[model samples]
Target: MEHDLPPVLSLDIGGTKLAAGVVTFDGLIHGWQITPTRREEGPRPVLARLFDLGRKAVAEAGLPEVAAVGISCGGPLDTATGVLECPPHLPGWIDVPVGPMASEAFGVPYALENDATAAALGEFRYGAGRGTSTMLYLTISTGVGGGSVIGGRLHRGAAGNGGELGHVMVRPGGRRCSCGRLGCLEAYASGTSIAERAREALAAGRASSLSAVELPTAEDVSLAAAAGDPLATEIWDETTWALGSALTDLVNAFEPELVVLGGGVTRSGAMLLDPVRAAVARDAMPPAARAARIEPARLGAGVGVVGAGAVAHDLLLSGKSDA
Candidate 1:
């Protein structure tokens, strides 16, 4: 899978940002642009701008040739069909044929992968899971999402969306989720959920330093927790509890050798990961727990781009080997 010398164009689509870059085999991003998605203007214009960004990234990288275009986005997106099936985070986006469009637009072969899945690959290829045969990557951001690699292969399911690890029920009938369910892992563990929980606590007249602020973020809560604010501590404890509980389930089910955590919420770093790791160790079935090692994603903000590029590279390499 080593490109050795060439770089691929990598694009990542998020609810808030549109990012594109040229990623080399060594996990370096040559020219990266982070732009607002402006999704309200709909998919067409956004895609046009995204394509333009890819072109700019290619030019800025000074690469002699572009091998391929790799794209990553949220799911339940169909990687096989290259169609986005109305991901809740992406409002008004319905069945957009991103792969074909990007292929045609870039005049090079293109590949699409779910953000979390690509992230798992990125981690496996260049991050915390470099030496592991089985790994899991979880992103706790606006929502909880994840993907896995098993036996050195991406564990994409029949519909290419197997690991909806975030949707797993953490507290049934608790908070409503973007997937229209209640008490999902996303509801309890996501940064949005963390902020909402804090806001609700404040609205309910909880005594805390956060009450001084008109609007508080998850980062504020984490900082408050670090400073020993009781209410913030309670919220942080619950966030860790839910993640630990759900991770116990994932560890038991997947038995991966390592678990890589990313996304905005992960900025809490050891504060967030430590408890989850302890929980899985204490709660998961014995053999599985013994097999898993929880850690941070090494790729940082470049994961999505590198991940998509990794997916494209793997697919292209597989095709070459097959032929």
Candidate 2:
């Protein structure tokens, strides 16, 4: 049945970039296009460009039309209403009616989902989580966010933003998170936080290989840690600890069959995976730990487009959207 579904237009809106593509049911993207978001221009102009990008993608993919359109963006959103509610990444964006606007622009139904939630579904349906009925997906990029699939279904949670898993408290009063909370997983494990911590350590007169770079990033810290830099190692260890601790709690609570880690930070590969895996293994409840296998995400840079596509396909399949 999935193979019979028509292709859909997928759009991903991010703080820094906008991506559009035509995605087939098999999780393959065609005619992918990307551009700077320039969010300062505000939602109206940005959405217009995103719609144009979708048209371009459809044209380039050689499809006369798509079944529907799917949209993925950062959360603090209302999925039922298809409105973006002040996502932190897009500071000035308020209650933008993304779903309706998208549908009107393309003359087709649209499904708007939290970026991480859609990514989770994408992974579960087509990526590393293909065979798993219960799984957790975390994207440790500019910010840490996650979503869960339970009993072979995506869990949208009460407010439609999924679980907001990044907000889970890992250390009380340890660091100020973007959510204004202290010690949230996002405050330590996010790529932004990793770079910030490394920069702060250098500013505080700590020595490390990271000092050679004018502005060290999470990738820099990862590289330095792998090369045996003391300060970098300290920060990296703390990052992995925060992730492992948070994941352990999640595993104990949800007992998912797999935990797939994605996003820009995951590019560090085993440098990030090995320690976090070890931590969850050592600290999680024995049964939960045994049931869960942490693995890297299979979809790479195109995940956002593929994720949006997957959401659209689900919408069509559910009879909630016309094809």
Candidate 3:
């Protein structure tokens, strides 16, 4: 069972939380840790704590040494230099040299990747997209983001973020998005948007099961709909409809072999997937729909860490080749 391949340390930075773990070649995590990001305190403190958590993971995993480190964060970031450049999700996080910091902290090389890109790699290497040549990944959480595997390798795009699928227009000039755009798909299909829309509806005195709750999250809305609330059902159906519409366009353009959906909202299970699948089948070009299978991500909550680990390992492998 002994081989020369060493385990990699992976870290995922989000607006809400920071996660770190030691990941092996077999797509397993050794020591995993997650905690809130507390972004109001700004980058220096949060990043210092994140690196500290990485050290703790390395120790808890009982690995003698880490081969490299991989990091995943929201874009617009510089994967080439491992710098985070003003991600709107992480307010005030600008020009942070995360890669160099991680490398120096761990005394090993590191790779910084867009979180969506990392998720795509995770799904491609070990999850729903494993057998496919070209696949797209969408994570629908605090925001909607995307990445893809094209020609059998992860696509890094011109800016390294690759295809920003979530930004695709589903409704032209509709709701305003955090990205300052109008009617983008993320403005409709993401968990944040779902909850926001529901809250707005309820605040306007719409009657529903969720109206009784002081704050109704997306989960509340989904549960309310499942329990047969008319208003909640309407909102839930609209969410699925928007997702299907955007995905129909994506399927036509990418013609990927598979589409993987991840993040918290997908936990609604078939409520989210079934309709989107049917929509793609009905609306997308028949050839493209036939070519792609829309499915859920298999790695679940650990995808970001696993993905960052994979990115780190790949970067190390590439560096060795360059040497």
Off by over 4 Å in 3: 1-4, 320-323
Off by over 4 Å in 1: 1-5, 320-323
User: Compared to the true structure, candidate 1 yields what TM-score?
Assistant: 0.96
TM-score attained by model 2: 0.98
The candidate, 1 or 2, that scores higher on lDDT is: 2
Taking the tens digit of each residue's C-alpha lDDT, what string does model 2 give over 240-280?
A: 99999999999999999999999999999998899999999
Q: For residues 1-323, could you state the per-residue lDDT of candidate 1 as single tens digits?
A: 43464577888999889999998777778889889999898999999999999889988989767677788999878887688888777899999999889888877677788899999989898899998898989998888889999999998988897588898889988899888899889999899988999999999989999998789999999999999999999999999999999999999888889998998899998899889988998999999999899998888888999998887777667663133
As a whole number from 0 to 100, the lDDT of residue 246 in candidate 2 is: 95
Write candidate 3's Cα lDDT for 1-323 as tens digits: 22446899999998889999999987899989999999999988998999999999999999768889999999999988889999988888889999899989988988899999998998898889887899999999888999999988999999888788899888887999778899988998888989999999988988888878888898998899889999989989989998999999999999999999998999999999999999999999989999999999999999999999889878766765134
Candidates 2 and 3 compared: the better one by TM-score is 2
Candidate 2: where are CA atoms >4 Å away?
1-3
Ten contiguous residues with the weakest lDDT in model 2:
1-10
Backbone steric clashes in candidate 3, count: 0
lDDT of 2 at 87: 90
